[model samples]
Target: MLTTRPERWDRVVDAIIVGSGGAALTAATMAHDGGAEVLVLEKASLIGGTTAVSGGVVWLPGNHHMAEVGISDSREDALAYLRRLTCGHEHDPAVLETFVDTAPEVLSYLEANTPLRMQPVANFPDYFFAYDVPGKKSGGRSCEPLPYAVGDEIPEWRDRLVTRGTLMSLGSNTMLAEDFAEPTEELKAELARREAQDIRTKGAALIAMLFKGLLERGVELLLETPVRELIVVDGSVIGVRAEANGQSIFVAARKGVVLACGGYEWNKEMVRAFIGYEVQPLSPPNNVGDGLVMAMEAGAQLANMTSYFGQPAMFDPEISRDGELVPQFEWGRGAPGSLIVNRTGARFANEAMPYNDFPKAFGAYDATQNEFPNEGPGWMIFDQGVRDSTRILSMIPGRPTPDWVPVANSIRDLAALIGLDADTLEATVATFDENASQGRDPLFHRTELGLMAPGAVRPLNQGPFYAVVIWPGALGTNGGPRLDTNGQVRGYRTPVIDGLYAAGNTAASAYAWAYPGGGATIANGMVFGFRAGRHLAAQPARDI
Candidate 1:
């Protein structure tokens, strides 16, 4: 794990991959196995990017393992489901078909060739699984990597991992796809007993195995190497210019270059321009959209530029962890005995909707005869009943309350503190309670979403309430360079750019509008990344 960037430059490799996340590493391993020399460049100091901090679930419909578990899925069904989910968005049909057909193939390849093995999550249901669509499914598409056993004798790799810290200390990844989080008393005791053993779960285990596979395939990885721009020879991308160890280095690509350097959530300008709202990113700061910018400069067309993969988040202005203020995701939205409302103190979308669809409710537009206000934040209000039954974020069950959470004995006081209409808040709570008693939502229908538990429908009429300000937050942007089915980066209104490719967050996502399930991004990232690697290896070597 103690690796350094090479001081040499002007060298050529069969394929140059600009990233070191799951996508980039998958590409590198496949390229090397295809009998081509592969080099991977990561802008961050460490190899694993944001993918390491994610929930580590991969959504692969009709994957080989599902049938073994008695769950049925097919390639045709997956395509139909994707088509229904995407609606009327302009996208390459060939690319969509390739994603569906090759999703399981890539999984099989990784399991057989690499150190990675995934098991289907039986309890995790789809966001739209309740519907009667032709290709609809109930569960088993989501697969999670098994935790890495401790005492493997890799201390250096263990030291390099970055934890999500307070944000995920108690988060629930999934029942079957669960990571090492939300430790109960018994689990805490077990973790303490195994503290020195260095058991890694979730993203840490995923990247470790991928890196091991890459090393076995003889792929060269260079960390702290930020690609500046693509090197074009007569309108065809042939290589990349990057910064390595404080020096400009030009590396030629004899076959192609794959851009998988994540997305632009940390780039304030890009976030402001596309989302039209202030956001606190859930991803690391290194995801500054360098690949996205470079692709645009290379005349690549952008898709889904106005949309992003985001959820609701907020900050505790007074609470700092590790001497810095900790911004927490508003998981309280789905907690029982709670409700979210706008400044007017009226409920908008279903509070229990899928996390990916929650933020979109704030920005929905009607264009026939435009009727909407600007996108804005909301107030998450809850009662002490919730504080008793569930953990409201960092709040301890019986500990003394902190000043960061605005509290009041009455709903009026809580509304006033959060700058909401007290009367409207009272009315909203009263009506919601009446509907909850009967298990009916004439409005948003929280029970129908399938993402929320019945606990989310508990009444909210108890005294002593709490509230917090929450805003739309993105984990990463899904827009970037367009690509064909074969993973070649596409130019605007023209043919594919020679020797240039994109995958992961740097490529415009196929399902631009909807999130298929838990591991939509990673599954697509790996599938297309492997495609880019094999495609680049098959091409004739450049004469540069």
Candidate 2:
């Protein structure tokens, strides 16, 4: 276990932040910069939570850097995109406006105040059905952090900075699977070294840079500190009772308490009860909805409790020693050569869809077939060409892989090995190969037809086929305690609960239907966190 010195006495800060992910850090930084003394509490030994384990990209429309690169986007276009994505969900219009309007400001602030850097990845595509909207630039306005270094500024935080070796990375576009597939051996070697050294890649790296800036600004970090309960006096939240190092510590927040503790992705009971599906989570194991519980207990009204984002994951009943199922993204979905199939041995969705949408599609497939939602594992079928050409991102325990599977001579044999229907599997492969030949996928419209072999017109013609069982997994649960446009929690028949705020995945998302692009979750988190901080900092402590 990790150790930290408990500070003596009873001093109050302007804001108390729980969780150390991008949301928590961003909120803390904004509050501190706004002239409020801020204290950040994390449950893990390190600062970065799930954000550290993610691709460090933020989907910001009309960002300054995008304009600097000659990619012109207007607030109208962004609003159109969001409206198409949300499709009449019960979202606050002000919150949506604030997200787009303040995204560039937040991007600018991070670039100026933090060690994080930004570059636009103009090639990434939005996950929405490509035909639904026009003028939606195929990968127009996403930003990745620059390579940030710890640089001996905070020796105490050296090991605590979630780096790449922890299966995470900070800034740098090359960490993305799309970028990682570069054929250059030198680039591959560099990535390997960076991963070994725990150098944070994408989101993790960006968050680490933010954390470095926070440390430089004399921000205090309290880790392994779980906020046990909220101290609600009268109608406002005043403080938090946290368990730090086996001792109960009452930390007063004069300005407010921002709950960024993330969602209960790993809490199986919560997942089944709230999300109505069985899921293996790809998020950090530590997210358990502590903030949601604390705030709900204090009478915060919850919204959108039934919705959750899902992804495809390879499943192994006993992949982890702790008996927890693991979700593998890079190996199962990101690999270029693989394709997913349902129990009837039919491809269900576009393999290239964003990870979150894959499982949603799977859920649809399950509903169509009258099967248990996400209970029946899907199959990921690939060929030797994929095994030879693609790189498998390391699989964590509990996620299934083909490492133990035997290569089969034909589709029929492969289906037999995996217990799939031989004729159905053959028909599915034939249609896919035919569609690939015509440079079109009629079923799912998967782009990137080149991954399929030329002249291999049917599944029966392929040799040494491979298959792995997959299941519905999630990055994190998206629904939680509902907050107003200002990140203030709403109480029972009350306006705004002052001094109590929530952001990140812990708060209900404004996006109700489709995720627009990559890095959207982090973007939402950072935007709301900053919004909460600024709003709270401007308020009087007594009112809070």
Candidate 3:
């Protein structure tokens, strides 16, 4: 935090929003619409943050659109479900209640004030659908933006927007959240047509819709501009010190500075300090904790620093993103002929569980041994039957296995090659196969085979086994400065930092340790971003 103002202000606005993800952009729109001159600064050259490359679903319980999908939600029901999930965590009930109460309003605002037209993901089950948690519904709390044609609708911004990662695996095909079945010929044709028109779907669509609204409102957005510090005037945050074109630029924010720049997974030191474990992030490479550091420097109190939106991931050496080898999002772990085993070759978690909760099980600690027993280099073991029938990570059925992947003729040989105990590995497989063939997982109590198709469990009895080292990864870190109900950053010395606000992954997560549904991250960020924008806009402008 910079206590002294610059001699000359390079630019001034009513609100300066740091970062350009869904949360930042939502705040920008809200502040701009509230009659504040807003400026958005992005660290990456691309306009969309992690949200652009994500699935772009927004989880909002009690949303009006839930009725369209034959699901009903109430504030009480949403709270009950959230409270149950957060029972043992250090989550704030007030913040959770605020998110539950304000999320529906935020959804309505985005639909009404922006070009985003979201529809309920019909029949898309919540992450905890099979769990015995009360107030949990099978589906309908999640919503996704309708596909938007950025190339046609916003040609000027098309080249600058981030491409959707889902396109990488699906061959650029697009689908609505409701279209879960295998793509038919007609569906394929429609998707091809949409692609030809440069119509973006999922996260890109969500960003494009919000971005379009921002552009129409004449809100200024600067890409490749990263904020270095917050400029404090007296006790209030009055501006930001940013860098653009190799020059330091001081931009004054009359009302406030909203730090929505995302999480710090890419910063190795911060990751080691806060998350005490390795987390291969699946987000864009720009989230390096700029907002987090600045907020800390500004005397902000932190919470939930150890939590993240967890993902069980397998790194593919052949695959790279932004010039680094990123872990492939785990796509094959829950397949019929697959199981995840620890270094001792013992199966640990319910492989069919939601990605967030599934990875948490990997942290199973042994007090007597003084170590995390299920920690990484854990392998996702699969048989030739799965390889012949499913697409495992980057491997397509009938295609030769990538040379980087380890393969062997039997489970024992595979375990030997991966440094696991051959006897334990073989025995584990035998026990799993017997119970799986009987359509019961007595060990993990797994209820589903895979997300792609629900069917009876298939034993991994075939020879020529394969193993991929699975790591405890994350979509993004969800811990940082803690925020109050109004989205204002809390201070150690004061009740609230006068003009400092934060939202999204930069703030301690609203859900605490629980991932409620598919788009909960996006929804929580937007709700608080909306709240911050409105609250900041309503405040009297501070003098620089």
Candidate 4:
């Protein structure tokens, strides 16, 4: 077992936070406000993990902003929607209730305590719709943080943040939370202007705000310092052991430790063991289950190991720039002349479904054919016009099709290129085009959703069709050490491990199947991180 010499502690604080993203930074800020001296440690040299490279939207149903923004959503309505979403998982009712009740508190707290400011995404829809209730189809509850100018904020830490991992931060382009309401030519011009301006939006802005808050709170943060093991004494977690500059250092925590050190996406062994498949990872490479392993060695109970957030992405060997495999999230699947078909050349899913829910369609099993994955490698079929209109991942839109991307002269040729029956492909396109011409998808009813844009429902009748093999690209693993509402990590059999807490992807997700809306993942982390920090700060100081 790994041990720590508390008497030789290098640094001691009331709270020690693991990771340096939204969750850790928020926890540090709150813990400091709660009168706890804090130290944040990040394994990576960069401060933001995937959170710094993502859309920094927070999905909080029934938040106060909903009412203020003219959204008529209630707590009961949010609960009912959640129950509908996770009803099959047999999840603890209290967790959902706590999230629903405390989400507003998390948002209000950030608004009051930090530089983070958010506005409601009045038009954003839940990844899944309200099947049984009215006004639940499209979510009016989602909100995104306002963008921050890099020159205006932390000019020194500019390069230390993770910006290349997300579409919003790609190149010099950045998008505002409110700009998503409508796509106009004027909007394009504005977007171009912002892209040239070096503005930080979405996830970057969130981390910047949180980082600024932490710095202001006097929290000491160490980059490239990984927690190697837990320091346990008499079955109690007293501190964590880490290595920096080839020296073993133990940081003592007087009150508690909040583990927000991300998830196990980069760990292939854990991926196969938990998610039942080997998926191309899209999260930061350092997310290799380090936190989960350390917690388990300390007797923490891990649960919901099978849940993950993923989407279909083509990992083209030639066009894989910066390991950009998944174009589904960036270009999105719903171009006017595109359709995703199974091995049988039949349209199996609503092409307009959000990427998170779209992955579930690939889970179809063909028992009669003995195919374990009936929809394996759903070929995304598009026409030259579609490719010409918009960018598909690393490949620029309106540009000639590259040799790396599979293409053909017609639907039959595309089917043959992708190993599908020509007749079936032709028929599927004929039926789909007929429906799309009328803005109707009678086969799957994709565009019927209130959340899906009408532009996504256009016809695919143009010539010179193209196809590409795509598989589910995992964003990250969601399962990890179990925690109570207070974010206190629980032991295998014990109710709670006293000085232990977890938040973000380091812990099992409360809702796992389908994404609630945009920024749901970050919002979950923020809410839980808020709880963990408050709970830890409320505790009396303990002697190291």
Quick one: best lDDT, which candidate? 3
Cα-based lDDT for every prediction: 0.76, 0.72, 0.85, 0.76
Model 2 Cα lDDT, one tens digit per residue, 4-55:
2225425577899988898889998999988888999888987789888677
lDDT of 3: 0.85
Pairs with steric clashes in candidate 3: none
User: Residue pairs in steric clash, candidate 4?
Assistant: 56-202, 56-203, 388-398
- Roughly what TM-score does model 1 have, to 2 decimal places? 0.91
Tens digit of per-residue lDDT, candidate 4, span 268-366: 898878876656667767889888987888789887787777655665555345665433343547776888888788888777766776666776676
| TM-score of each prediction | 0.91, 0.86, 0.96, 0.89
Query: Which parts of model 2 are misplaced by more than 4 Å?
Result: 1-11, 125-129, 165-200, 315-325, 330-338, 365-375, 392-403, 433-439, 447-460
Per-residue alpha-carbon lDDT of candidate 3 for residues 273-351, written as tens digits (9 for 90 to 100): 8877677777877899988999999999999998889877777777776787867677676777888899889999878
* Model 2 CA lDDT for position 503: 90
lDDT of 4: 0.76
C-alpha lDDT of residue 538 in model 2: 83
lDDT of 2 at 504: 88
How close to the true structure is residue 528 of candidate 1, measured as C-alpha lDDT?
Answer: 88
Instruction: Give candidate 4 regions above 4 Å deviation.
Output: 1-7, 129-140, 163-165, 168-173, 178-199, 316-332, 367-370, 421-443, 450-460
What's the TM for model 4?
0.89
Quality of model 2 by C-alpha lDDT: 0.72
